[model samples]
Target: MDKRDWLILQMVYAEKNITKAAKRLYISQPTLTYRLQQIEKEFDIKLFYRGRRGVDFTEQGELLVKYAENMLKQQQDMEELLWNTGNEVRGTLRLSVSRTFAFYQLPQVLKAFNKRFPKVEFHVNTGVNIDVIQSIYKQDAHIGIVRGDHSWPSNKKTITEENITILSYNKIDLKDLPSMRRISYKTDPTLEMVIDNWWKENFSSPPISNMNVDNVEIAKRMVLNGLGYCIAPSIVLEKNDQLHKIFLCDTTGSPIVWKTRVLYREELLELAMVREFVHFIQDYH
Candidate 1:
């Protein structure tokens, strides 16, 4: 109900233990326990299932925790709006992004943003594109950068174009690719969409000989080490020249060019800091 309660809930959810959460919050264990009891009394639901490893959230607790976290974020955003109503650009900007973009594309953009608005602070986290979108939607993060088709929701904006290719070490021959293993996205719809349209025109089946990887970097590493071939953005080649391209996919005949994007909540569009960052990246090209 109050700010402290929201903070306590978030910490408890993150740490999954009352004692540890209390210690981290600089509060006594009994006090923390009492507060949690008060929350359960107020909400009329058990919030956690105690276990030897850690506390696990009940279904209701999981839902409430997400609500509480989002509410806290909104409160923080409101406070920031009031505090910086008429001043230099300043406020915390929590941005989520995929690992590939975080490592490959974001550093330059962040450096430029920081140089332009030195007062602004950031909380950045990296994961796969799906998790990044969930972070923005949950209000755990303010913005997200990800690769997708150009056809995004009305709220999303395309930031750049990416062409994915199946590449192997230059020294290796393409004739051996069918016999060798391959690395690819794990049931990834985005890549599967590409492969579907791509393979229909080129071959009868998708690259079934390959193994699915969790991420792009691991695939690139495997390809670099000659473990297998991988399908990745052309930027990977630009970033690591030594990997050497064996072939470029002729995706011109297919609708498979991956569009990288910057997405934020539609409701936050009017916020000056948010708009500035969005427009900054939108205008980058």
Candidate 2:
């Protein structure tokens, strides 16, 4: 079997559903099924059994999946090694980034990087900061960009820092936080903890959340509409936005700061593409 075959097997194993896997591989459902049949015939074994919900791998199929994973990983390593030995920074750069950074910063950085290394390719995944960290730890990505502080045992560098702020359409006092309606979003856990701790330090009661949003961008919009006030990292806020903002501070009156970091395994730095991309990010802004 070739690399495409191995990739099909891996995608099928990850997605379980043939239709989903076919869509991800950019192949027709019938084509994917035919390929799977060919692979099974070549091995003389049934790799999976389709049920009402999806497909389940047999014991042999599980073994094949492991083999496919190892083969793909080795192939990637070889490719990276070859590219590293050469002077050209041409290879896939797998990256995982927090949603906020992905939305606010990644596009410009990627545009500039692509201009510099036109032959280089990117495989990017955007999620919460914890997910970004996990991707780096698992070696699923060559690099990770995360917000807030995390205790990751890897090479990391701070890219930027911003203050967490209480934002509203109109001016408000710190003591009025408990009385006002607060807009909250599901975001980085470390940021959540910081905000929670800051709120708890000054007041006996929790800040009342008026709306629950999926991301900080939405929460910021809601706050701008005068729906409610929100606690947000300053990076996501636009400078020209008319919202009144107050920087959150610790009990000693120091600003509560949020830092963005780029994380990666030390060994990945050996690859030219990874090294170049990391350097580009470090010099960005």
**RMSD to true structure for each model, in Å:** 4.2, 1.4
**Candidate 1, residue 212: how far the Cα is off, in Å:** 4.1
Candidate 2: residue 7 Cα off by (Å): 1.3
Q: lDDT by residue for model 1 over 51-82, one digit each (tens)?
A: 99889999999888999888987889787787
Candidate 1 Cα errors over 4 Å, as ranges: 13-16, 20-71, 150-152, 171-176, 185-187, 205-212, 238-240, 246-256
In candidate 2, stretches whose alpha carbon ends up further than 4 angstroms from where it belongs are none
- The whole-model C-alpha lDDT of candidate 1 against the native structure comes to 0.77
Taking the tens digit of each residue's C-alpha lDDT, what string does model 2 give over 192-280? 89999998889999889869999889999998899999999998887689988899899898998999999998988888888888899
